[model samples]
Target: MRAIFPIVTVVIVAIIGVIVFHLLSFPMPWMLGSLFGVLLTQLIWKIPMKWPVMMRNIGLLIVGTAIGQLFTFNILIAMKDTLLFMFMLNIVLSLFCLAMAYLLKKWARIPFATAIIASIPGGLSQLVVFAEEQKDIDVTVVTFFHVIRVLFVVGLIPIIVSLTGEVPGAPAQGSSNLLHNLSLILLGLLLLPIGKKLRLPVPHFLTPVLIGLLLSLFKVDVDPMDGHLLHIAQLCIGAYIGLLLHPKSLRLPVRVLIGGISSAILLLVLTFFIAEGMVFFFDLDFATSYLSTAPGGMDQMGLIATALQADATHVTIFQLFRMLFIYVIILPILKWKILK
Candidate 1:
């Protein structure tokens, strides 16, 4: 009974969010709607909500497969051309993180370790886990900063895209072959454990994505997912993220919130400049460049690219590259310098 009430309430909130977003004709209505709906419900009612991890993993699998359908030999070749630019951008973003940390330490009176951890543009889960190992850093503050930054970017970027007058085409109507769809599903399921064994980040999603990309390059005729299935996936992702918002986690002073917001805005501005550089140098489209440079998580940014009808292949390549670089190169340096 306890679980049932929270589940029912969350469902009701999700339904209302979907309806409202649909009425407003918003892009990626299911995702944004459910996110906002559950966030508001949790904040106002203080109700305890839970989103099953299994549901979120299923959503990741679907999204990863959909993105993989965009991959091709040509896309791979194009990504190779931008490798230098991606590496340069990583350096620039790292410097920016250090600058932001300095400002937070000076203005907000936060500890240097906490400021630096909060300022890093890595994945939220990665940052939180890293914070757990540090003695003086505040995990709640880092989480609060990341959650707010994600909300800001996700909400604002879609509106910016809409104003640019590039309406995405209708979702592809996939093949009606039940057998083919089942085969694809089976392939994704089989890859999940393999991805885990390989220790891939976000294995449920990345594993399917890697498999789908291989199939796409080989000209395999896997059908695209139906629009309804995609929406369900979005709903699961949005609800899961929404349930993570614990208002009590944000117990910092007003000045700390202000500082975090300011730092987030500064990061967005820097992202805009970097994206413009990519467009100017690489001759890429605006949406793809912006999405590639955005500091949001892999899945969230990928979804935004899909929503905006940008080159999902390019966006995915850049985002995955940056994520891997942060985890591999930048994080180790930070651990050595800051922890020692």
Candidate 2:
């Protein structure tokens, strides 16, 4: 009977994965992977096993560092105008999300830690990586809300693009760039160990970007095209997201779901307007502006930009800026406020 549960759960999620892989692209595929794991845990393993902590970290490292491959000094030069506006907008949105988290924390009577963790704009696995220290982490609740957060943004991507007269995103030349890919693998392996040992603020998920930038500034060559190697890394990420689920975690109550939905609505509405305002500030098109600033998962947002055939490159650029900004800049500001 116990074995039956795990078996059925795996089968169902695998089928869901196939559908998601075919219909969805990039970051949406991450969500589909997450959803499958959530369902499997709910139906089968009611017993809690600790969230697969290492798998989660490795996945974050893989995807986050993979992101570094997308960068080049030329891109940085092009972003000068866009960067200033985005910096201000990300600050505003981060504050906005912080306020919403406080409100939800009060309504739910959950711990400040859980609220803050759930409130973080992107990187679910990274946030929850620290959640185990809680007296009662309520991993399910945190997981549920962040999951919905991505789904909300992803679900709205096609609709938003259509309204703005945008087409699906095209693949970028740099996405497969040899320099980016090589730098990523080396960056991933190098910084991950140091990140774990030093207990750094945001960990080494973005280590590639930081390191790559340093190397670029120093004019060092570290070119290697190996996204094919990234496939296993992606699956590792999927598995980490999957391991967070337990059989009972999916049985969320009505009030919690309602509150989460309300919070999500609050987040999306705020992100949209902020993104639009950023467009005016940067002289960008409507689609690029909105998506670039849409406060969500880095990869998922990029994928949405990719699918729409819009300025995904620009959108992705902003997302990267916002992520690095949040992880590096805002985190210190927040340290006293929460992270500490």
Candidate 3:
């Protein structure tokens, strides 16, 4: 019962955030509100709050399944043309991150390995674990850097998209039958363990997406999820991220803090320029292009795509390709050339 208390407290706080953001007409209120609510509460009050990893995994499952339903043969065919483009985009993004890492190393006087790992735009939890495993890497600094970056990217992107006055695409129709939707969600839940067993990075999220994509290719008709369920998922993820960075965990100098924030802002500026190039070359909307190029995790970008009614499949493909590139290719090179 004691363990359950903190969980309940956290949920209540997140819900309050949702309500406040909703009232304020904020973009992605359920997510941003919950994240800020929990984050600010913890920072100011230093409350003893705990959110379990299970909550985050459940959220990912819902989001992944919904995104998977967006897949179709037509979408896949459209994506085929972008394969080469995404490859080149990832290369550019990697080089840009390396440049940022170099600046961080020089400004903050940290090890190159730590700066590089922190600067790489990957999942926060995974990078934290990777940093923890390395010798002579400051996990605290890396965590601080990523925490600041993710916060800035997630907080800023939605507002920017909304400010452009672009309306979301029409939401797809789902079966009106509540039972059918529940059944479909259960089927997705069953895939969670299979995803875990695959030993892939972000298996909890990507596994459902891959399975959903396969099903969609074969003409399976999974539809968009109910808004309420999606809201809950967003709330879960937001709360998890909100609770991620405790002010107490950061003992670094003010210079490191400034450097981290400056790097995040610089990365966003660079991404905007690259996104403009994509808009010209690909003939895609600015929202889709910007979200695709933003230095954020696949899950966060996917969520933003869905919210903004952008081509989520396109964003997912680009983000996933970048993620895999970083993990499989870039990390290996860094390990051998730099970390060694």
In terms of lDDT, model 3 sits at 0.83
How does each model score on TM-score?
A: 0.93, 0.64, 0.94
Looking at model 1, which ten-residue stretch has the lowest summed lDDT? 165-174
Candidate 1 versus the native: TM-score? 0.93
Give candidate 3's error at residue 33 in angstroms.
0.9
lDDT of 2 by residue, 113-217 (tens): 667667767666555654554455677778877766665665565466567664545454433565666556656667676756765444645565456566667
* Winner by TM-score: 3
Runs off by more than 4 Å, candidate 3: 172-176
lDDT of 3 by residue, 8-114 (tens): 98899999998999999999998999999999988888567999998988888778777877766687787888888888888887898899888888888877898
lDDT of 1 by residue, 205-239 (tens): 77878888789777887777656667887888888
Residue 36 CA error for candidate 2 (Å)?
A: 4.9
Sort by lDDT, best first.
Answer: 3, 1, 2
lDDT of 3 at 249: 60
Best by lDDT: 3
Candidate 3 clash pair list? none
